[model samples]
Target: MTTLLRNCRPMGGTAADLLIEGEVITAIGAGLPAPEGATLLDGQGMLALPAFVEGHTHLDKSRWGMGWWVNEVGPRLIDRIDTERATRRGGFDPATQSARLAREFLARGTTRIRSFADVDTEIGTAHSDALVALREALRGTMDIQVVAFPQSGLLVRPGTLELLDQALRNGADIVGGLDPSGIDRDPKGHLDAVFGLSEKHGKPLDIHLHEPGELGAFALELTIERTLALGMQGQVVLSHAFCLGDVARAPALYAALAEAGIAVATTAPPSRAVPSVRAMRAAGGRIFAGNDGIRDTWTPYNMPDMLQRAMLVGLKNEFRRDDEIAWALATVTDWAAEGCGFAAYGLAVGARADLVLVEAETVAEAVVATPPRRLVLSHGRVVARDGVLAS
Candidate 1:
C-alpha cells in the first residue's frame, strides 16, 4: 500500500509530504509529485509525530480497584496486587478486558506499548496469559511488548522465578523484577538469581524500582553490576529509579549508568527528578517517560495520557521554551528508543511508516491539549482514522 501524507508539520519544520510504501517511509520532503497509485491524506494544520510508545505499564492492574477505598494510601503497587487477583479470579475475562484496554490506547494514539505482566504465582498468572493473547490479537493495530515480571520478590515468592521462566517459555519478550530491597533485602542475591535466569534464557530484562531510599539505591546498584557482569547483549531498562533523584546520587549514579549502557525509564511526572534527569543526560545518561498506570489499582488516577505526561515532565523539569518541551515529549518515543538500541520508527525515509496526526499547530500545544489523534497508521496501513471520509 502507498500513502501520501501532505501538508503536515513535523519536528518543527515546514509541512511536507511523507511517502510510505508498504511498511517503510520511502520519502519525506515538500511538494514531491504523488507516486503512481498512492492514497493522499490531507494534513492541514496538523502536527504529525511518531506514534506514542508506552515503555512502562502494568496491564494486569489497569483500571482496577477504583473507589471503595477509605483514603488515598501509600505506594499503591502492592495494594493493586491483591485487588487485581480477586478481580481476575472472580470470573473477569482476560480477552474482553485486554481488548477493551487496547482499543482505548489506540484511540488515544498509543501504537506501541511495553507492558509488564505479573508472574508471581500468588497472583495466578492470569495477567501474563491475557497479555500474551492481547499481543497476538492486537498485532496489526498495535505493537505490544510483553515482559514476564515478578511483581513480588523472586526469592520471597517461592516458585515465582519459575513462573517467570514459564512466562518466557510461553512467549514473553522481557524478564522483569521489582523492588529488590523491599522483596528480599538481599539486592545482590535477588538480582543474581533474576538476571541469571534471564541471561540463561537469552531474554532482555526490565526491573521496576521505586527507589525507596538508600536501600533502594543499593538494590539498583546490584542490578547494574550483575547486568554488566553478564555481558548482556540486549537492553536493560530500569523503570522509576526515582531514588537517583531523591538520594542525592544523581551525578555519580547517572555516570555509572551511562557507562554501563543502561537506560532509566521515568514514566511518572518526576516533580523531584528533573535536575537529576538533566544532569544525567549531560553526563551521558538517557531518560524516557511513559504513562505507568491508567485507572489501575496501583493509582487513583486512571487517565493514561503519555502526551500529557510529557507535558508534566517538561513543566516539572523547567523547560522554559516550548520547543524544548516539544523535544522532551518526543524523546520517549524517538531519541530514547535509539539511545536504548531499538530500530528507528520515525518520519524519515527507510523508517517504519508509523505515525500519528494530531489537531495542534506545534508539538508543545499537542502535548498540553492532547487533542484526539486524527489519524493513526501502522506499517503504512490505516489502523484508525477519525471523522467521515469525504465523498
Candidate 2:
C-alpha cells in the first residue's frame, strides 16, 4: 500500500510530502503528487523525524503493567540484583511484562530497541527464550535485539558463563556483561568470557559498566584492548561507562574508544556522572541515549518516552543552544539507531518508513517540549496516533 504523508517538515525543515511505498520512503519533496488510490494523511505541518531507538534497556525486569512496585532495595548494585533475582524466582511472566513495556515504547515512537535479558544459573536462559519469542512477534512493527546479559557476575556465579553461551546458542542476538571488576572482582575473567562468547557466536557485545572513577577507567581500557585485539571494533558497546565523565580519564579514553570504534550508551542519569556527549562526539566517538529501567524492580522512576529521555540528556549536559539540544535529540534518534545497528533508518529517501510526527515547530522544541506524538508509522503503516497504539 502506498501512503502519502502530506505537508510535514522533515527534521523540522521546510514542509514536504513523504511518499512511502511498501515500507520504504520513495520520494520526499514539496507538493508531491499522490499516486492513484494512495492513502493520504495530513501532517498538519508537524515535525517529522525517524522513530526513536532505545539503545539500552532491561526489558525482562520491567514491571510496567503491574501494580505500583515500591522500590525498597538497598543502595548498592548487588541489592538490586538480589531483589530482581528474588522477584524472578517468584515467577512473574517475562514475556507478558516485557511485551507491555515494549508496546509502551512503540506507542511512544520507539521502533528499535536493544534490550538486556538476564541470564543466570538459576533462571538460565528463560529470559532470553521469552525475548527471542517477543522479537519474532514484533518483527514487522519493531526491531528488537536481545542481549544475553550476565546480570549476576560471570565468575562470582558459577555456571553463568555456560548459561550465557547457551543463551547465545539458543537465540540471544548479543553477548552482554556487567561490571567486570566491581561485580565479579575479576575483570580479566569476565571480559574473556564475554568476548569469547561474542567471537564464538559471532555476535556483538553490549556490557554494562557502572564501576566509577579509576576502577571504571581500568575496565574501559581493558575493554578497548579486547575490542582492538579481537577485531571486534564497531561490534562492541559500553553502556553507562561512567568513567567517561571523569575529566582526568575521559580525553584519553574517548580517543581510544573512537580509535577502537566502540560506541557508548548513556541513560543520562542526573545524580550519577555521565559522559560529555559533545566531547565524545568531538573526539570522534559515537554516544547514544536510552531509558535504562522503566518502573522496574530496581527503580520506579522512568518512562518509555525516548523524547523525554532526550530532554533529560540535554538537561544533564546543560545544553542551551538549539544546535546543542538537537545533538541531544540525535542521541535518541539517529545516533541511537546507528549504535543499535538499525540500518536504513531516518527521514530520507530510500530509508525505512519508520517515522514519528510530533506536534512541534522545530527539532529542538520537540526535544525540549516532547509534545504528544501526533502519529507514528512502522513499515509505512500507522502504528500509533496521539500516543495510542493502533490495534
Candidate 3:
C-alpha cells in the first residue's frame, strides 16, 4: 500500500509531503509527487510527529472501560497493592479491559507501549496470558511489550519466582520486579530471582524501584552490578527510580547507570520526588515517561494520553522555556521510543510510518496545549482521526 501525506510540517518545520510505502516512510520533501494509483490525504499543514511511545504502564490493571471506580486505598504502596490484589481476585476480565485501554492509547496517538502484567501466587500468570493475547490481537496497529511483573513482591510471596518464570516462558517479552529492599527486605535475593529469570529466558528486565533515599540507591547499585556482571548492558530498565531525585547523590549513580547502559522511566508524579531530566540527559542517561496506572484500583487520577503525560512531566520538571518543553515532549516521543526499543520509529525516511498530526504550530505548543490528534497512521494505514479510532 502506498499513501502520501501532503502539506504536513515535520516536527513543526517546513511543510512537506511524506511518502509511505507499505509500513515504512519512503520519501519526505516539499511538493513530492505522489506515486500513480497511490492514495493522497491532505495534512492541512498540521504539525507532524512520531507516534507517542508509552515507556511503562500497567495494561492489566486499568479499569478504563468500566464505570467510575472509587479509589479509597491508603497512601502507602503496600496498601494500594493489597487493595488491587483483592479487587482483581474479586473478578474482572483482563483481556476486555486491556483491549479497551490499548485502543484508547492508539486513538490518542500512542503506537507502542511497554506494559507490566501482574504475576503473583494468587493470580499467577492470568494477567500475562490476557496481555499476550491482546498483544497478538493488536499486532499491526499497536506494538505492546509485556513484562512478567511481580507486583506483589517476589521473595515475599512464595512461588512468585516460578510464576514469573512461567509467564516469561509462556509469552511475556520482559521480566519485571518490584521494590526489592523495601518490599522483599532482601535486595540480593529479589534481584537474583529476577535477573536469573531474565538470563534464563533471554529477556530484558524492567524493575520498579520505589525504595527511597539510600535504600533505593543501594538497590540501583545492585541492579547495575548485575547488569554489568551478566553483560546485560542496554537490556535493563529501572522504573520510578525516585532515588535519582536526590541531586547530591545522583551524579555518581547517573554516571554509573550511563556506563552500564541502563535506562530509567518516570511517571513524574507531582507529589513525589522525580529525577532531574536535564541532569540525566547531560550524564548520558536515557530517561522516559509513562502514565503508570489510569483509573485503576490504585489511583483514580491519570489518563491514557501520552501527550498529557508529557505535559505533566514538563510541569513537574519546571520546564518553562520552549527548548525545555520540547525536551519534555521528546520524553514521550523520541526518548520513549528509544528507551522502549521501538525499532524504526521516527519522522525520517525509512522509518516506520507511525505518525500523528496535531493542530499546533510547533512541538512546544503541541506539548503545552495537547490539541487533539487530527490524524494518526500506523503501518501506512489511517487508524485514527480527531481523537477517535477509525474503523
Worst 10 residues of 3 by lDDT: 240-249
TM-score of each: 0.91, 0.99, 0.99
Instruction: List where candidate 3 sits over 4 angstroms from the true fold.
Output: none
* Backbone clashes in model 2, listed as residue pairs: none
Q: Model 3, residue 70: displacement in angstroms? A: 1.4
Cα error, residue 294 of model 2, in Å, equals 0.9
The digit string of per-residue lDDT tens for model 1 on 1-391 reads 8888888887556889888888888988889789889999898848888877777777656644334433344556566566656555656555565666666667666777788887777755667888998899877667788888887668887888778888888888888888887766667767887787787788888888875667767876777787678886236888888777677765777787887778788765643453345766788877777777666545555355567767767776667688677756865578555544456577788988878888887777887777877887777876777622111
Error of 2 at 241 (Å): 0.4
What would the per-residue lDDT of candidate 3 be over residues 190-275, giving only the tens digit for each residue? 99989999999999999999888899999999999999999999899999999999547799999999999999999999987888
Name the lDDT of candidate 3: 0.93
Regions more than 4 Å wrong, model 2: none
Clashes of each: 3, 0, 0
Each prediction's whole-model lDDT (CA): 0.72, 0.93, 0.93
lDDT of 2 by residue, 1-391 (tens): 9999999999989999999999999999999999999999999999999999999998898988788977788998899989988987777888998899999999999999999998888888999999999999999999999999989889999999989999988889999999999999999999998999999999999999999999999999999999999999899999999988864858989999999999999999988889899989999999999989888888888899999999999999999999999999999999998888999998999999999999898999999998999899999999999989997
